[model samples]
Target: MNYSHTTLTGDEGPQQQVTMFLTRHTKTTANAIDLIQGWSDFPLTQEGIEIARQFGRGLQGTRFAAAYCGTLTRHYETARIALDNSGNDNVEIRFEPGLREYNFGSFEGRDVSTTHQAVAEWLGYSTVEEARAARGPKFDLDVQDALYALDAENMLHTDLVPQDRAESADMVKQRMWQAMTNIGDLVSREGGGNVLVISSGTAIRQFLWTIDSEVDLTYLGNTAVTKVDYDKGTFSIEQPVGSMAYYERGAQ
Candidate 1:
């Protein structure tokens, strides 16, 4: 239950099995500023740099069989810093584009607070949730309200990030599942070993979604790692790494 030990090097070996250590990227300046960063490439803040170093140091002795990261600088830099600090400079870090974040089209780099206000005003709703609620039962929606929701959803996700592109949680889930399948293949081909994957909070939430369909992305611990073990067609979750909750497949 002591998941916050700050050391993972002890969980490595040539043990005829594959183990994945999934970590979220460190904090960013955009995060500190309450911006809807989405796929926008933001450089790491000074604290983010230090956090990466500390994370790497914590895993110093765990020699990874392979490492994976996304194309984003946030993910790449976090992995590089962690790997470099952990003396894993020799590990071939594989970059996979499929692991990128959900594109937050029109909202990229915009202040979430202001964006919410604008959305609320545009939809004739006092709040963003009111807008969403109106889109469902109990509240009547007008033609413009529907269009605003469509635009807002687009602004939440997309690669080119159109002026009015929004992404549903389900959309993110699909891509993340695809990435997992990709990682599973990579592990299977490598004959099983330890892996260190560096990705963003959104992608990480998708991974959590892969296991728990009811998981809320907003509630996931950003800096926490999630350890997953897969073998013999079975998957077991080891809670949120650094947290006291260690969950296995269903009830005992």
Candidate 2:
């Protein structure tokens, strides 16, 4: 596909635009079991592998100038499978720790219901359902804030778990923004072209939230692609967040 765009500047004539394909990693064992993965590393499920293959097949004709992924097994595994199936195996996948998911500290590997229950209490909601209804699109981000508060207070601390280990919403947003900006800068320096980036669900959402908080944050399915355009120094979402068209196309 022709992912490049050109814009006329007052005196600069035309400028090249770089396209960023930000994708969420496929389902993992933790996800399959309804666990809060956080910074934990989990292998992709068999179904996840197949879906990633479909994501690649859907973009069979597209070429990327660069590829990047978080320094997690799930992240790299998804990127590898998609690139291999898409015939872009030749592109080197760069690992960036800044792209990793939010650290949930003691909450890691816990049941989602359990975590949400605690978060609801921390946020002063009578129940998780109440919290969800009250916060609506911001509920997910509120969960992050509640987790950070719980961690900071040592509410769930054990000998192995330490206080203040979880990342606050601000921290996640800062790091994700920096990581994405750096990638954009690097690709733009290389003459601006299409780029592929694989990251976790929450991390990807946090990054997009930084760009536009009004974006829908209800859910982001596995292997869903969120297209963004980079030109000069600005980033803009190309479509609604978390479009599963690629996966659906590949399924056909």
Top-scoring candidate (lDDT): 2
Model 2 compared with the native: what TM-score? 0.91
Candidate with best TM-score: 2
Clash list (residue pairs), candidate 2: none
Which regions in candidate 2 have their CA more than 4 angstroms from the true location? 1-16, 160-164
lDDT of 2 by residue, 1-252 (tens): 122222222343344688989999998999899999878898899998898999999878899888888888888889888999888989988887788899998788889998899899888898999988988868888888888888878777554444437888899999888888877776776667998898888888888888887888868899888998988779899877899998888878
TM-score of each: 0.70, 0.91
> Candidate 1 lDDT, tens digit per residue, 60-110?
677888777777788788888878877888887777665666665556687
- lDDT value for model 2: 0.83
In model 1, the runs with Cα more than 4 Å from the true position are: 1-16, 116-149, 152-164, 214-222, 232-234, 241-252
In angstroms, how far off is 188's CA in candidate 2? 0.6
